[model samples]
Target: MEEKKVRIHLEKHYWPDEIRARRKRNLGRILALVGLVLTFVFGWVVGSTFATGEPVEETTDFAKLEAIYQIMSEDWYFGKDVLELQTKLIDDAINGMVDGGGDIHTSYLTSEEAKQFNDSLNMGFVGIGVQYYDSNGTYIIERVFRGSPAERAGVLPGDIIFKVNGAEVTGIGSDELAAKVKGENGSIVEIDFLREGVTVSKKITRAPINNTAYGEMIDAETALLEIYTFGDTTGNEVMDILDDFETKGAKRLILDLRDNGGGYLSTLETIGSFFVEKGGILIQQEFINGTTDTSKSSGFVTVDWEKIVILVNGNTASASEVLVAALDENLGEKVTVVGTLTYGKGTVQTQRPFSDQSILKYTIAQWLTPSGKKIDGIGITPDVVVELPAIMENGFEPLEEGETIAPDSVHVAIVSLQEALSFLGYDVDRQDGYYSPKSVEEFKKYQATYGTTVDGVLTQEWISRLHADVARVWHEE
Candidate 1:
């Protein structure tokens, strides 16, 4: 027994070391499987992100963008030019900010769109300055600018632009349709429209619409002037009207700018000279750079201040407003601002032809009054705000007593008769939305005043006098 105890050093198994080594081997196997799964999941996520097929940001790195672009080009993922893709991206970005739906006043331009945009700014286009958009998935004209080709062709404000040159224009984007309507100056463009319950096909010629309103005189001392624009020539045109008015013995004036959009700044400056005596602050342009001061009568234009009225509405904007503000400040009672507030466009825009052979127009300055009133979003309120009083269907018709008028039909046909009667201050009390006997009587009086044919009916000659009167007084002011 003693010998056995001394000799027995039998090897005991090293259980802890063996078990530790085996555990480590098992952990390595598990880690290998997890890494495989992670690689597969990451690849799937990357693929899905690209293949989602929607308009979205591709990636945030130039290298990623380059790689994706190269793959698309070489792998034939899409059948289109890379430059075209870039152009489309640019167009989409622009349209998001400035398009038919973005701002009715501002729009994005393609090469074709550039043509249409340039045409609009130039006031030169064929298919009547009308634009259409999808409503309930069908296209409809949003509006037709007054005196535009469409309007001249008797196109209504709500007419639908459906076909151009015999092509279905439905779902045709606004930018594309606008391009189709624009063409070489003086060229004819054909359009098919749904107007007043009838589908009419009309061909319209494109030209630069004149910005000057036609002038007319009502009675001596009462002039009616219709202002179309405030272009550079407008000042000279008003001067011409004044010379003519002096001949007609017309002293009281009425300026009508109901549907006139705006134009050049110089014209307003010239207008200010007439009512604003000597050189004072007519209008000041506040730009990012500095303020531009425009003084009154600098070039020596003058106007009669005794009795003048400037008529304006939502359409009167830009330069027309400058005249209103100046006259409102200087002429006071001598000038009567008789309509609603004038359009409050205080910002100035400038156009320059680019070296890239493209032209760009940008907002340059904001306008301020001599009293330093900001002109954007807030128009000049008139002194005597007189609306013709909205009548039935719209009181745009003659203020007759017992007659009813056809909707949207020309009151012009019978308006002269009523307006003539109104001049004698006849029974305009009827305001019956029709031409009546009272209107007839007024018409006769106007005819007698002009010593024209006493037809007892409103004729072109009678209308002419009224228009001239409005043009002389309101427009020149």
Candidate 2:
């Protein structure tokens, strides 16, 4: 491995607020479902306030909280800045309120977090377009967006991001690594990575990356629409995609919502209006006060004709659920859901920014389908279930040196390993629940190519790599 020094060029001045705002307006600020978006019901309410009729009974004694704050501020073993302590206290308090309640969707966002959340809505960011995860000790590329600078630069899935700007980030936290990769548009960020034990470096120009929805005709009669996330412009984006689908003569559509975490409620409603009938109920929201509100479709039906199949996985949630439920309820036999069950987030969140710009995303109401089905903890079951095969994390046991499993071996783990290998494009002749000679040969070739021990045996590291490779290809394709 060669040591390389890479310097990132930074902009000298920040864009004016007006210019930034204009850029945001120009860019469709929304992800399909991963990025947070304002709720449709409360998005219009800014700086809302409530007048208390009476002092509510305190659930917990305030004196205990005060004592803790006093002890931390004054009597702690180490001295701390009052402002910093105050900020931490506020953050913890908010966390306790939401997180402690066991509602994963409700969250507190600090000023920085709030900024990032808002930035994601812009649908554009300056970075080498890749989403990664920190595995045991390596930073593995989970996804490389199509046409991204990273993709254009030959960044591939399952590649280990060993260094950013020549600095080793072996054990770096995800947030810190993200900050390192993101910069002003047009800036350069050098990335050094390990692709199958080979060190590769690329000088990537950070540019405005769009989180766009994808739609392409898979065949003359079938089209695939992959919704990345619902953002400000997603409704229009979807409409444009449908137009293209129509132009290409696609009659059957596959709506891929797998891994979509849910996005803007407004975007959901807008998109739902296209598939649902005019004046149809999109979702029913029940507030904490026992009052409920029913959101109806805008009565605008855009595309007409044929069958639709919605693909959902465990990560499909929130607004995505809304869209799925709406179309399922309204279209009935026209829509069929496939894949695993969804994330099952039935609650809607309202975001409010405080004076200090910190944001609080608290649950306001529970959303129900038009038929009055509540899908909170219990997710919407698919009509056609296609559960993904589980990837063995570093297989059951490493095949030690000098020990070769012949075709007679009937271990269940080997069967799983063979399946994974085949899924990742390896030519494993047949996955017949046995470790055949061809399987061993293919495994040895894979090991040799990736610099693994070429002993034609499995190890923990080898299995983990196999799992990652399969996942990468599964997701990317």
Candidate 3:
């Protein structure tokens, strides 16, 4: 296969730099105190006041901590290299301090983790573009980006990733698998995946991925815009789509934010301005210091719509929820939210980078909708609730090539198979895991339509076809 060249785009958001500068300035006094403590604890000097002439209160907590460190470093029999042990001890102490706060969002990231986190928000990485979900320990591809190496290499949605670069991926976390798959641009990654009970390996070249939003005309009058994330260039991508929609005379808009985890807050504000009028409040933030801040639209209404539909699912969260709330509140009944409840992530986090390039991402405030409704644990309920089929949510179970669920068979897997058939418009009598005569009839009908053998028994080939057809229809819709 011929490899296609990919262009990489980099656009920095201003807020990250601003936050870093502000954090550095504010941490000056704290760092000075830390320096004084270190100097006193190491027996460099004993002083009652700080170097800047501020009276410092004496505390024994620092001495106790030093004593523990000394015992661990000098007396512990299993201790390894002194320098390596010291680094590990410091990293653990920082992690323990952050984890002790009882907030899940507040985290301490090592230098490598910090880089990956920032790269994710900026969409700045080279990889075989794909999004996956963790099923127990197995990773299943949920989406394959258009024109990406994965898609070009015959990777498809619903495929089970078995290995990456000859390493078995079972029992591995999603992040670890992703780290294994991603590499330098033009590098080849060997991916082994399970498709229709068959494991196939493909060597795909890594490429820079820039896609965040995709738009298409659903009909002459309706446009469908799906945003995967709100990265740095999301605002610009949204504007270009709106421009095309205007040119095509699309009046009804379907903004699909399903599974969008969200990115920079500045991108949210910029995109929000495209719909909400200037000075209209989009969100309200309540800081830990008992202060509140309001974020308003920037008066950049690029286009107006006759009607709008915002599609959200359980994965829609954070900045995505903010946009849904803003549009629904400001646009009145013209905007409709469909799909299941969104992910409740109302807290705001800010990252401060250390001199060693590690980062501390701490929750600074909790955000509220424009209506002052707090959705921390409570997600935003959709106007029209639409739940996906169980089979789609919890993937299909793997089967051997000749395995067949005969007519009158009753098994738990039959329930999902029935659901999959029903979702594909098959008239299965019931979804109760019983392969009744009617269920067999529906299965035969599906097989005949797809040019498969018209056997009543549900074979692995039929199951794979059914899953692929359902996935295709779901993507189209």
Candidate 4:
């Protein structure tokens, strides 16, 4: 008898540069061939129709679209140059058609937008990689990715971001601020941060960042794995972490998918294989034509865990929800889902690229769980619902420096302060945005314990201290 050899395949992520280069080269040849064929066919059709003198039947609703285009080209007074106007009209037509489909996810993207979309999924954006949260009007750095430009530039968590590129970020949305910070890979961004009552400035060079999954041992037998997105590298990242957990004698698992919006379907299948047995249904898709397709596990079980806990929140959507549903249903009683309800985005979309390098990403199917439960618009309910404090969920109003909310003062900030104080084990009479005498007493107690001035006045410094303490306790928990 001959000995048999088995080969195990691991998914590897390709760098954006190589992937884009290869795509452009192949697409260039394809577009050239397609253009020649389309030109010849269109010329022949027009010539034959004109020669026949027979009316072209309007079989489809859009059959007269070319006539409408001709009318606009010939008669529209405000039309720009022929080529530019044609391009604009074609893009507008595509958008109108897609928008009429009534699905928000099914839309078109320009060439540049398509590139950014792909980069987001591949985790290959060029920027100072830092995640921030809006504290009232102030943006605070919540997380600085390790080995990133921001981390190298001494950007620390809890630092208040004041300005980007000399423009104040006080009134801008987080997305707008991020756009101002991100640029070409070699470009430099000037960031002003308020740290410990001092304004700190840093000039950081942006670079490509690739990060998704992270893991660490939480206790003797428990391991915590946090997956930010189901990107191309996520499978290998999860595998390495699970292997490390096994080596450290950890059996219980806590998979955190809190704000993960999700990414590629292929990555989802790869990660799903670890928890689900081979041939088990991971997800089912029902297409427009009423055909159904099933995705099964690849049978690459990495760890034999005693128990698994999945943490989710409202922002946990799409592929993240798929994983939670698959594990909860397939693993039966062994898996537990905790935290708030997930984001309901259960539709599957596929993209088609145009000759212009633009893309049309349209919904093709609606996904169902293993037990055939439709998750579209109806999110997966967790076994344990652990809602965050109201103030934490909805951010608090910021108090300016030297501004204090004294005793008997009624303000919305008082409500937030009371909530934070209550969460930190301080005794408070009311959390209704009223600074009553009882609230003042509790505030003084907190100040005394934290070694701040024992005055019964709320300052921005005190709020900052309270915020830090709240964050520390939550992190430890």
Clashes of each: 30, 12, 0, 0
Put down candidate 2 lDDT per residue, 1-477, tens digits, no spaces: 895432111000111121111111101111111223222111235686645444434444454445555555665434354446545454444344445665555556656666666555435678888877655556778777767899899888888888999899866676678889999988999999876667889999998777557788878899899876666677888889888877777889899887666667778888888788789999888889999888899866756759999999887877788889999999989999998878787887767655656555667788899888999878889999886664423332334434445445766658766887777678887666577888888888888778656876665456556656765676566
- Measured against the true structure, the TM-scores of the candidates, in listed sequence, are 0.52, 0.73, 0.73, 0.71
Rank the candidate models, highest TM-score first.
Answer: 2, 3, 4, 1
Better of 2 and 3 by lDDT: 3
lDDT, candidate 1, residue 39?
9
Model 1 CA deviation exceeding 4 Å by range: 1-83, 90-208, 289-294, 387-477
- By TM-score, how accurate is candidate 1? 0.52
Candidate 2, position 226, lDDT: 85
Note the Cα lDDT for every prediction shown.
0.53, 0.69, 0.74, 0.75
lDDT of 1 by residue, 145-242 (tens): 55677668766544566688899785566557766887777788888875433467989887555445557777757888776656546677778877
lDDT of 4 at 162: 86
Q: Candidate 2: where is the Cα deviation over 4 Å?
A: 1-68, 75-94, 120-122, 392-445, 455-464, 475-477
Tens-digit lDDT track of model 3 for 86-131 = 5445544444555566666766565676676677765678999888
Question: Model 4 RMSD to the real structure?
Answer: 9.9
Clashes of 2: 12
Q: Which is the winner by TM-score between candidate 1 and candidate 4?
A: 4
